[model samples]
Target: MARWKAYFSFKLWLYSFRLKKFLGYWLAVFSVIWTFTEFSGYFFTAVDGSPWKPNVWGVIGLGIVAAIWMSRPLLRRTVLLPDQEVMLEIDINDMYARQDGAWIIPCNRCFLHSHIDEQAIVVQFRNRFFPSPADFDQVLAQVLQNVPYELDTVRGTQVKKYPIGTVVPVQLHGTRQTAYLLATSELTSQGKGDPNLNHLEDSLKSLWSYIAENGNTEPIIIPILGSGRHRLVVSRYVIIGMIVKSFLAGLAQRKFTKRLTIVMQPKAFIHNQYNLDEIESYFSCAGKFEFDSKGL
Candidate 1:
């Protein structure tokens, strides 16, 4: 009887286990879906009863939106869904220019790398922190009240200052927006950006968890992770896809209230590395946004 009870208990536990992960994924899925709906939300009238024509104004509006996005250092069009949206813009002109929203910057397991030598967050240090470069660890320790703690699951499994997949929140100099010091990769001896997708996924999972619990509905800005100095060996083609898949799979299952944007550099987009047209098509695909009609 005890054995049977234990087995039953384990099964029951699985139902609610990692509910947060479930939420994140579904919400992300919904974001894509919602954006597609918005893009296709157009209908034209035919008083003569000949045929229902596509709305020219609507098409023009979408074109204008597309033009604005293209003009900016953007790869993907801004996707607004249900109660949230996702954008792909450039941070080249100004990395920390946004007045609001939490800025997420990737760091190593130790969170002790130099911005000059390590470009993962060079933009933040140079433009955001300004004046003198920031001592990130010290900033985390003193300002955010975070201490380096050991977290397993990455390649460089060492006693480190910060936990893997967790963020150390800090405030930028000129702005009141909080800077979420998100650790996306481990300091691989092979170099930076080599942290396996599993680790990156976990870090992203941690990101959603933080937003759900401690974050408001403010906009959040993150870059195309692992595309910088760390240089993860994975093809650039899959980087955005991986991020989208992981993020949508990790958004809160119901009532995801935050706006998320992925910033891409203009040079990268212009170089034809990522097919912007394809990305635009992907967002507008009706099939990709299918979900239950429970009204999230």
Candidate 2:
């Protein structure tokens, strides 16, 4: 029964939408199912008995769509965390302060920046290390002087070999959560590639590899990494869906936990079609499994 129900929704999505889009199609879908139900009723009437006698499939089809809509409140309002069975929750909330979970923050190969980014997660994290009223570069120098490493500060940030598709875990002091400096791009050049899907997918794969090897066994909390400072070209919905896919794929390697939590920056638009509500709707139900991408 579930398989057939999924098939109906999948076919509706497969028709015209590529990936990361299903909401608008969903409206049209209700009509399509209505028409299917009517046709089924007519066909059954001719073949067996009165059309009104039983239209079980039609009722089921409409019921499924209604159920999806009704479930939205639970999907959006609840804080669904990743656990042993692989469930994901989407929230346009803070990523830094999540409970004992590790955070996966993206960075350039050189994890340094001139000024704090107003929209990126790094800004929220800056105070944790340098505090306020402190010069970012100078504070970095003073902080780095005590550490035993052969790195230098440049471009408003410290440099490293964290090229695209690499992740460096920066363990925090007096905290259970470690900060993963997920390297998503070489150095975020102006005219060059920012976040092509190939790089993003590979980075996700690398991130999972690190998790698998380290065996940290902590619930993971990650922001939508590329959308803000990284200037990733993908739409929010598309990227979020991509993220769920990669994360789920990673879990298959080893069930990191039962739930995966993603913290989205408060958003109004992502390629104009996606939003946190849709993200909640998609992942909490059939959309996550049905979604796929040609670019990635």
Candidate 3:
């Protein structure tokens, strides 16, 4: 029953004009193939010497071809940028369980590891990567030793707050892979995260710079920053656009990672109405943007 529902959902998406331009190109290709095959029977006559006419079987075969072509956009959730080795994906899965590459976990400026809730991504990172909370803090401390703090305050749980774009690469246990703890959100007086668009872009820039120096061309998995608890006053789609734009700008300067996956949980994908086809379109057109040293 669930499979049937999913099939219908895909069917709705298939012809919904979300991928209309791609669908149009594929349909044109199939039409040319059919036309060429039909005319080929005239010149390269078979033993039977019968001209092939459009029949039910041919129509069914064409339908199958069309279905396969349309399904390509919906089925394959990843896209490679034009003339670039870097691959971009919009994966609908848990970021931790999906890959072994460096994961970017958006964190508050304070770099607090003990105060996050059970549902936060930071807590999930601790549970998945570390054997215990102490181990997580140990790795975090080792990475943040060189990172400078912007201000010192006696208020809230943390006294020192790191600047925006501060990235702490946490070396996972028993593996050489690293997970970047990116400080994208500012810690407010009430202990809530205060993330803005400018800060998000800065954090991403810092993330790519750190990865370029430290990463080994491994795939990097990142969630849509500011889409979670920070709740930046922007659409999830816009946040995704920002992430891709920043990453591509970074890529222009140097090749850091071979692949970059922008992970969205299944719930977020459904609730936010994210279309991978649309994301792919956005990424393909990203070539026009110039990479400036200031920001994307």
Candidate 4:
């Protein structure tokens, strides 16, 4: 009897949590109500009374309640996904060492950092910690010597005077390699973007294109673009959503496999910004991905 009770309790728990089972119960209840309404309508018509009116109202009310309940689960699922699968810690002093097919390099002059992948590197510059152009150039030269491709030309620094939320993809050391620099004006002026969705879209689109072109065969390393001291006020959810949307859009256009590695500096900040639910939601929406923590 105890075993039977335990089994029944498990079944009840499953019924309550499983979406299919919950919907099934609602559907069955509605079906029975429909049948009763049909029979009562016929009987009431014969007796000169209306029984179908209450049945119709009940169905509408039940549907509204069911819809509200169903939405709760869907919303939770959407918000709980993980945006970036792999997360690594990077330090300024040990930036040259290779880990998992990539290197995390810290800039000498500014808070700006670079994640060097097999084919390319993503350099994130926070306006709050602006590095001199010469300092940036020197670091780039040093980093290029260790990379696989030859440095030809550096492109896309023309719009440096623009506001926060500007993303410029430049040709670094020629056309063989590229470095995408995401600059947010908020970090420079007040620290944060204008919460403009279009700005986020533009930034993601540029990053996505770069990833789609270069990251098909090699792993791409990225940083938490705007979550630093520059834009310290931004919500993790919004940032996560923007990253996920951009990656998905970019991935959809690609015909090959890609591995993206996102590196976070000051790891404690990222941990505080996002929780397990956001990470889970990002993965669920992203399809196939993995998560790991790397200490630099």
Candidate number with greatest lDDT:
3
Whole-model lDDT per candidate: 0.55, 0.57, 0.74, 0.40
Ranking by TM-score: 3, 1, 2, 4
**Poorest 10 consecutive residues of model 1 by lDDT?**
3-12
CA shift of 101, model 1, Å: 2.7
> Least lDDT summed over 10 consecutive residues: which range in candidate 4?
89-98
Instruction: Write the residue-wise lDDT of candidate 3 on 218-279 in tens digits.
Output: 88999888898887989888988888888888888889888888887666655555566677
Clashes in candidate 1: how many? 12
C-alpha lDDT of residue 79 in model 2: 36
Which 10 successive residues of model 3 have the least lDDT summed?
A: 1-10
lDDT of 1 by residue, 1-296 (tens): 32233223433234323445545544555455545655554443357754455555665555545443333322235554443344433232233555556777777766655423633464455444645445544565574344547644434544354666777767665657777777776665434445466667677777867776777667777777776665676755466666655555546343344556666654444333454445545544422554432221
lDDT at position 137, candidate 1: 49
Q: Which window of 10 residues has the lowest lDDT sum in candidate 2?
A: 70-79
**Of models 2 and 3, which has the larger TM-score?**
3
Model 1 C-alpha lDDT versus the unseen true structure: 0.55
Query: How much is the lDDT of residue 223 in candidate 2?
Result: 74
In Å, residue 178's CA in model 1 sits off its true spot by 1.9
TM-score per candidate: 0.59, 0.58, 0.75, 0.39
